[model samples]
Target chain A: MASLGSIATAPLRAEREGDKNAKSIVFLGLLWFAILFAVLALVVLLVTAFFDGRTRLDADLITQYSSTVFPERAGARAAILGSAMVIVTTAALAIPLGVAAGVYLEEFADPRRWYNKLIEVNLTNLAAVPAIVYGMLTAGVALSIGLPRRVVLAGAIALALLVLPVIIITTREAMRSVPQEIRQGSLALGATPLQTVWRQTLPSAIPGIATGSILALSRALGEAAPLLLLGGLVFVTYDPNGLMSGFTTSYRSRSSTGRHSHSWRFSRSHRQPLSCFWSCCCS
Target chain B: MECDGVDVYYGDFKAVCDVSLGFGYNEITALIGPSGCGKSTLLRSLNRMNDLIPEARVEGAVTFHGQSIYAKDVDPIEVRRRIGMVFQKPNPFPKSIYDNVAYGPRVTGMKAADMDDLVEEALTRSALWDEVKDKLKQSAYGLSGGQQQRLCIARTIAVRPEVILMDEPCSALDPIATSRIEDLMAELRDDYSIIIVTHNMQQAARVADRTAFFTALADETTGDRTGLLVEYDLTNKIFSSPADERTEKYITGRFG
Candidate 1:
């Protein structure tokens, strides 16, 4: 009780004692410096990118095609469409499967089983496997399976695999966050273990699952490294109409155009806003 | 309900050793002990709730009526259905009052048609229907702490379990709520066989028909701890004249 009371009043006494300590002020300043350091970098990137691409912030940026004929009329319409399709397809493939795998591991899988232990170790290591490796794997599989190269399906599949581990891990964490008491309450009421999980634990974990899934999706969306390895749809001039339609990502359009077309490139001297605008969006 | 030389273990460490007790039909039996005494563990083992813990295992015979519950052929789900429990905290599902009580029956494959009557009877029996009946559609979380516990009890009883195990059910509740629950327990004593694990001696004396005293003995040399059942008898007799020194010390608040 005395210790608890001391803890309650400790802050006031701490500041009084801290008044004469110059090290404390330095420590506070160092903490603020650390905070501002990170914030400043992100702010600078966004602000510079914003200023450089302010003129290209028009419907033309999204609606125009990538054109050698008329570079100004060139828009990222195809890439935007392609990225959206790939992300949607990736979500469709990953969400249910990842969440299900997560639920299985957390709720049912026994660590005593050798196969389950192997899976547990593999999940952690799989999350560390580079996204580009998935793209290469997708490419090899697509070639072996006689599927066409450079289509939206290839990109979606690669991204889905890339994010699957993340989704599973997050879903497991989310489900784990639901208090065990809830499970006990359900089971104590004669509900089966399956029923307890389905009715109580899952619903309670949804908010956490949603937050985790969105973070994983956003990270996948911003990625450009994986798309580089997949075939044909690198720089498209038309909108993606289907899963098989040839397409370019918004990042790919800017990067490919910048690499091949030097005159339209956004070098330091020539701060072409549309090219930098896509870079900002990707970051 | 009876357990013969039952021992509970978590992994290789024995939590409770050679514990035995029998509960009478339609009686409230209280298990009182300090922390780490495994009173809660013994309570959980009664309905096979210990099966939920991966490392937990039990030995010896635990029987409901004449049938050994731990027998290989007996379905644990069926055992749990016959013996329900209420936890220390009031953990109502994040659902409406009606849905919370309706959950137990619905999960047990009881028909939806008879659910209304069961829910009402459960709530009334647990002394929560009058307060919550008007807003059955409202979230169970909106109720006060005491009210939520009664609702939990109502939900537990909705499935019509023969025995109810309570693990410090009123520990989180205030005095008023605690008293209400105590009153409800007396009313419930006519129908349900109850075994409650309580830390409070007064609560055990106030409500329990029979009381079992438990204490954890720690080895000084090895630093190993195991829970032992000290004494059990009529509530009055155990309180007034305990059989074991540990039980007498604990009841007199001198054991520590």
Candidate 2:
């Protein structure tokens, strides 16, 4: 009976192989098309940017201040410096605070407690809130406190608020990736929870935390809506000297019209390096 | 270190019930049981290592050196400092072998001049010095599994604990490494009190001075499993002539 069954199924097995081959070939073709489609879009975007603004790429475009009448002589010096200061300030404010909050939530806080649960739920929701809303919060606070409007301080604070949740979420994930065994080993050695976190947990999590912080900072650098709401959308000829000084980021400075177009190209130039760094961080 | 009528609870569920055991100075006591028998839980309670879990609470008393470790004024850090642990799987920090051994003393605030001596002494005591002496600066990950386990032992010893709790220390090792660790246990027993939890009955017979057998009791109504100590006696007596029928059955491999 076994020999008869094998003889009967041999032809059927060969026919099924033909069907499987056709199915796999179709899937392979579709996958190839999808990959090509993504690559093509990216290639087109890069080529267009290069072709449209190739001539504007020069020393003057980065060194000299923006010009109203001489569009050709315009530069993004102030916007570049302003964006750098704001991002650096944002990173400084967000990273430590975010990582600390993450450690508390992941390692210390009891998940069953109502208050800790509330914080967890709220943080998840806040991460989804639009960047424009964070701008409004900064503007409202600046106005209520009677602080000078549209300074680098206000913008950086707004950006920090926007990216804080991202950093915290990523940091929590990074901390979670560390095995429970490592924590147990450290604590069994008689180290306090704080000591375990500082010595064992945090060091292992640095790579993930650095990557998250960089990605969040890159997103902060590209945000124009929040800065606009913070009243930093106006043009500034001189670079920001300090955190409290008037400043204009690249995104805030980009607009339509002749000199604005030249300045917008300069803004794109500023964005390029940020995005490049972001990709490297991801890899 | 000793526990009296200790009941461990994970949140609302009882994990281990009415466990009473004691460890004398310069002696080795082994806790033996099948899987999920809460032997590890009882072992962890000795040093209050269970306190790391937010909801894991222990009823009754676990005293170290005549002081209740769970007393309101006593710190768990101090308890752990006096009673270190070596885990089932060797966990060497992703650091140099030298640093791995040095970590415990450094954390406990040993003087810099004394740290070098402490690290070297620990490595030598754990019997890993000869194999790794020349590669002290190399990463701990470079060591074999057995070597790493010994390194962990050295790291624990560097803290100078009065007692060391080892939870299935040789379960992850080969027969040769297991034998090496068994020998190390015998040697270390002359210095510090050791409490080991093992599934291997032969291992308990080999190294343990006192043996305690834990068995899981399944509640028919609730279907909840809770571990309880069945018998505790001298290792030779427990192996040769056990008092309890259940202990005999388990030892003879009739049933868990």
lDDT by residue (tens digit), candidate 1, A1-283: 4776556543544546644579888988999999999998678766766775577678887778777566555677777788789899889998999999999999999979999999989999999998889889988998999998688888888888999999999999999989998998888877888998899999999998998889989888877767778864556777788888887775333333455433122423235455456544543
Candidate 1 clashing pairs, residues 3+ apart or interchain = A64-A75, A65-A75, A150-A231
- What TM-score against the true chain A does chain A of each candidate get? 0.83, 0.83
lDDT of 1 by residue, B43-132 (tens): 999999999999999999999998999999999888988999999999999999999999999999976577778889999999999998
Best-matching candidate per TM-score: 2
Candidate 2, Cα interface RMSD: 0.9
List, residue by residue over A1-283, the lDDT tens digit for candidate 2: 5776567444533444653687799998999999999998678657756775788778987897776666566788888899899899998899899999999999998898999999999999999999999999999988998997689889989999999999999999999999888888788777888888999999999999999999999999988889888988467899799989989886223334434332353235434664344334432
- CAPRI-wise, candidate 2 is medium
Candidate 2, superposed: residue stretches over 4 Å from native:
A1-20, A251-263, A266-283
Residue-level error in angstroms, candidate 1, position B220: 5.2
